[model samples]
Target: MTTTLQINGRPVAVTAEDDTPLLWVLRGELRMNGTKFGCGKALCGACTVMLDGEAVRSCATPLAAVQGRAVSTIEGVKGPEIDALRRAWTELDVVQCGYCQSGQLMSACALLRHTPKPSDADIDAAMSGNICRCGTYPRIRAAIHLAAGDDRR
Candidate 1:
């Protein structure tokens, strides 16, 4: 099947099976590797991407579901929220293994977009699905807060 999706900001047409995971389309067909594959079960946020400005797991999202919809991967994400996240992430040394940072950033970007000033509880709830084996949760939280100009740390 051929599906045309608005990736980042440009329209991209890709050919794949209807049920093929969006992850494969991005990584395999499109040669975009920013989104990682961790569990392939959608349990991990490593495959997270923005679908119309909302974070969705590409591993579980099928090609048919994203046809003609806007999809933003780590490679294409930009703007104030993402810029703040990148700065805070780097300034706070939020990355350890670096496998999950893209997913974490994507999720965090969504959180900031929805809640410009999120509480600790909100951060926890929004980031609960993303797992960091390196145990950088504290730094991640601090980075989010910093990105939001909270400075609660």
Candidate 2:
């Protein structure tokens, strides 16, 4: 099946099965490798991407679900919030191994989009699903606050 999708504000056509995971389609078909494959199951947030402005697990999301929907991968994430996130991630040194940072950033973007000035509890709740083996949660939280212009330590 040829699934037409809106990716990063561009229309892209992908030839894949309806059941094909969006991760594979993005990585294999579209050659967008920013979204990583972690647990394969939805438990890991390493394959997180934005589906119609909401953070979703691309590894588990079917291609059919994304057809005609707007998808934003790490490669396509833009805007001031994302720029602020990138700066914060760099300044705070949030990435250790860096395998999970893309998903972390995506999730953070979604959180900030919804709650521009999130509390500690809000950050905790929003980031609970994204697990960083390097345990950089403190830096991640701080970076999110910095991106939001909170900068409260």
Compare the candidates by TM-score and give the number of the best one.
1
Best model number under lDDT:
1
Clashes of each: 0, 0
Q: What is the TM-score of each candidate against the true structure?
A: 0.98, 0.98
Please report how far candidate 1 places residue 48 from its true position, in Å: 0.5
Misplaced by over 4 Å in model 1 are: none
Cα lDDT computed for each candidate against the true fold? 0.95, 0.93
lDDT per residue for candidate 1 within 1-69, as digits (tens), equals: 677888999999899999999999999999999999999999989999999988899999999998878
Question: How well does candidate 2 match the true structure in TM-score terms?
Answer: 0.98
